[model samples]
Target: MEVRTPWQALTRPLAYPRSVWPWRSAGYLASSVVTGLPALVVLAVLVLFSVLLVGLPLLLLAGVALGGVERRRLRIAEVAPAADPHRVPDVPGLGAWLRVRAREQATWRELAYAVLHATVLWPLDLLAIAVCLGLPAALLSAPVRLALDRQETKVVKAYLVTSYPQAFAAALLGAVLLLALLYPLAALAGARAALTRALLAPRETELRDRIGEVTRSRARLVDAFEAERRRIERDLHDGAQQRLVALTMTLGLARLDAPPGSPLGDQLAKAHDEAGQVLTELRELIHGIHPQVLADFGLGAALADAADRSAVPVDTDLDLPRLPTAIESAAYFAGCEALANIGKHSGATKARLTARYDPGPARLTLLVQDDGRGGADPDRGSGLTGLADRIAVLDGTLTISSPSGGPTLIRVEIPCPPPSA
Candidate 1:
């Protein structure tokens, strides 16, 4: 598997030594000095003048800014990007932004993390890198040191190397030690990344709120889409359909006025027939776009209308009241698609549709079954997948169970409040 972090890289023991992760880890730890030094200075100044009210706000600003920088630095040890835990201000301008940031728990948590990093964490990070990498590097340079000094050299400032052989031996030992120490170095980097993520990433509750917002936005889009469909349906029904009706009537009258059995009369007759056919198709298109019955009378009447128009016989057991327009529309279209699929592919001679609303749970349930040679697969380019996606936007679910020999069943469950609610 591809490695994304130091821990994953460490899992491949043989590859770890040759890999760049050791150097990456060292860089990640050593770079702490860059951030830590500034943080320590700023924090010290804040503490010195903390008795003044100005220090408190400055400290908050410093912590919030440092948190953003540290989250970016975390990428050196971690491949996956960290999500900012803080929410955007509802309004623009600096005052609004500061008020929102100051009110969030994440801001305080980040401030705590900043304090810890400045006082303790960064120092420990530098110390680990020094012990693991700096010492080995010093030892490895013993041969060069001996050559320069010509008499003696200090090995890691601890042992004396008086001869070239001794220096070479120290270097070999340093090489082995460096390789061995890198495992722990990489492990430490991974731990640091995890801690940074834990402190800076969005909490579970925040994540849930984000997901809920996205769901709500998607639902609004779906509502807008349904509204557009209704608008188009209305335009076609009121504007185009009426105009086509007038054209068809005019052609009929012209056919009657033309010479009997003449060529012009025959052509007029053909044109009139064609106009009537076009009008019929346009009406069907309008109904398919957004059925007037579904909007005016609710899903029950719409389902009955759909069943009446189905190619195969369909029996419906509907116990539905007027539902929210979105739910009713979604359920109606889903049922229509199911019956259409049954007629097109299922080879079903008979089908059944059942729908009801449960007031206790505030849920709506719809089931469509067919006594056909059942091998329906929505993944095989069926319209059901898109319908299912639409239903899911409403926090509803659509499931299908079609075994190979016979009998296909599709169940749809949607949690919705009663229309009164």
Candidate 2:
């Protein structure tokens, strides 16, 4: 199996030595001096002159820059890429960028990491490389040192080697030591990579904030949709519906003036009847688009109006105050659909609709129950599936309990803002 992390590679004692991970780890640790040294110099200078007030901002800027670089550098030992936790500025320019970075927790964490790295981590990295790699290299070059000097030579600045055998022996020992130390060196590199990722990657709280922003955006879209529906409803009610009513009245007046039993009188009556039917259909269409009662009174009266029109006899026990428009719309549509289904397919004589609102948690619950030959399944192309999805967008739930024999119940519960007083 392929290994992605140093710790995972360490688990296999044999194949790890043969893999390319050792070189990768060595490279990661060796490169620490590149960024760490510059960071140390910059941080020291900024602190010394920070009384000027300019140094503080520059220091933050430096930290932010270093954070970007370090996140990229983590790719050496970490297979998974680190995501930048700072949000992009709304407007472009250094001023907006700085303002956004200053407000992010990632920026502060990066600054702290930079400080710790400059003071402590770089020295440790340097020391580990020197002892683990440099020492072995020096020992392996013992025979060459002796030959070049034509005399005695100090092995690793400690053991003295005078003869060829001693020089050769030191070289052999160096090779063995180099092989043994690679494991710990790779392990150390893995630890360093993990620390860098922790400071630079997105945090749990930042992820939560991002999810919240997305939900609010969806809610805004739902509100805009409802507003557009209301606009269309208003236009039809005040424009086309009113014109049709006037036409119907004019046709009625013309029919009354015509001679009784004449062809003209029969034609006028037929035209008047057609116009009246058209007006009634338009009124129903306007109401379906968005009920004016819902906008004027609220969900309670709107559901009552719907119950009065349902083909299946419905008894309602609802005591609710005004709610958010989106919530009210969703609940109203769900109730209307339930009653329509009952009238068309339930084969029941009566249905009951119940609604209640709890102020403690500010939740609204509506129930529609019908005593019918019941086997309602949303998966079977039922309209309840659409109702469930719409409710889900508002962080509400739709549940149906329908046995095969009788009595289908649909319950909707939504957390909403407190009703307007």
Candidate 3:
């Protein structure tokens, strides 16, 4: 069987020689010796020429080249392919590429691996191949050597073989040694592949890429949510709200036409009153889903409308340019929620809504404060938790400060550019 990695070959002791694993392990280690020598020469030259500043770029180039070579070599002993952690430069220029590479941790890690392979790892590879494969082959030739010399021969320079029987016995010992050494050979090769992966793999780069993807995905979800909200609002306005208005109109006309003091007249009046009430409730529900004022006139006007509708009298001092739809929606809803909470829970009879847009930082700040019995806890179903999550999607912040005595304040800040006229 063809095992991809040394570890897999190590597990099947009976099949070690019948398969290509032994030769592969030998080739992998032998190749390291060849690759390691050039690395040592290049690194040594780079260090010696450091005073000329000519070697720095060459050193980086060598490290990068060696990193590629190491990853390819890992295939001889690893089933899984090593991942490349280097990022492509955003701009296509040497200077841009260098700057990007210099900032990456992967570049330095590869350099360290190159240095270690040259100084330490290659010699180990050579020694492992020699001890595991070479000594056994020498012993297997002991009988032939004894016959040719017509005298005793030393096997591996350790065992003496004078007669044919003793020479054959030495050859048998060599065969047994070769079989025993196969497992250690596989183990050493596996360790070398693992070390190569650890040094050359781009694990940190992959993590950063994944985090960026998650952030962008979250932004997309928030955008899709807002689009759905707008669609619902449009359907209600153009379909259900218009139908209810027409129904109310029809009932009003019927009530006027009905004869006075009659049962039919009283029934028409009741139906008309019920339709008008239902229409009013539907309008409120539609506004709650997504306010039309906020979409048409922007956040400042929407805040003023919300304050006017509050049970507690609210004063407004908002000055903002039109902003991005997502920013405006989050800020408006946060304000509305704070106001609703104040009216229901806070005993404060008066509230103030203030908003301002700062051009310098491209930020919008909204504050809602009330003189009410305070001590509000978001964790206790205060509804501010959802608002905080919404603000976070825009890379914004929501803060609440409510003392036990009175004066609760809710502040929201969102980073977004002011809308163009």
Candidates in order: C-alpha RMSD to true structure? 11.5, 11.5, 6.7
Model 1 pairs in collision: none
The TM-score values for the models, in the order shown, are 0.61, 0.56, 0.65
Q: Which ten residues in a row have the lowest lDDT in candidate 1?
A: 200-209
State each model's CA lDDT, in order. Answer: 0.90, 0.91, 0.89
lDDT of 3: 0.89
True lDDT of residue 81, candidate 1: 77
Q: What digit string (tens of lDDT, one per residue) describes model 2 on residues 1-421?
A: 6688887889998988898888888888888999899999999999887888878878788888888989888888867678778777866898898899888888898889889888998889999999889998898999999999989999978899999999999999999999999999999999999888888785664576678789999999989999999999989989999999999999999999999999999999999999999999999899888998999999999999999999988999999999999999999999999999899888989999999999987899999999999998888777999999999999999999999988999999999978877
Q: Candidates 1 and 3: which is better by lDDT?
A: 1
TM-score of 3: 0.65
lDDT of 3 by residue, 268-368 (tens): 99999999999999889899988999999999999999999999999999998889888889999999999999999999889999999998788999999
Q: What value does the lDDT take at residue 357 in candidate 1?
A: 94
As for TM-score, the candidate ahead, 1 or 3, is 3
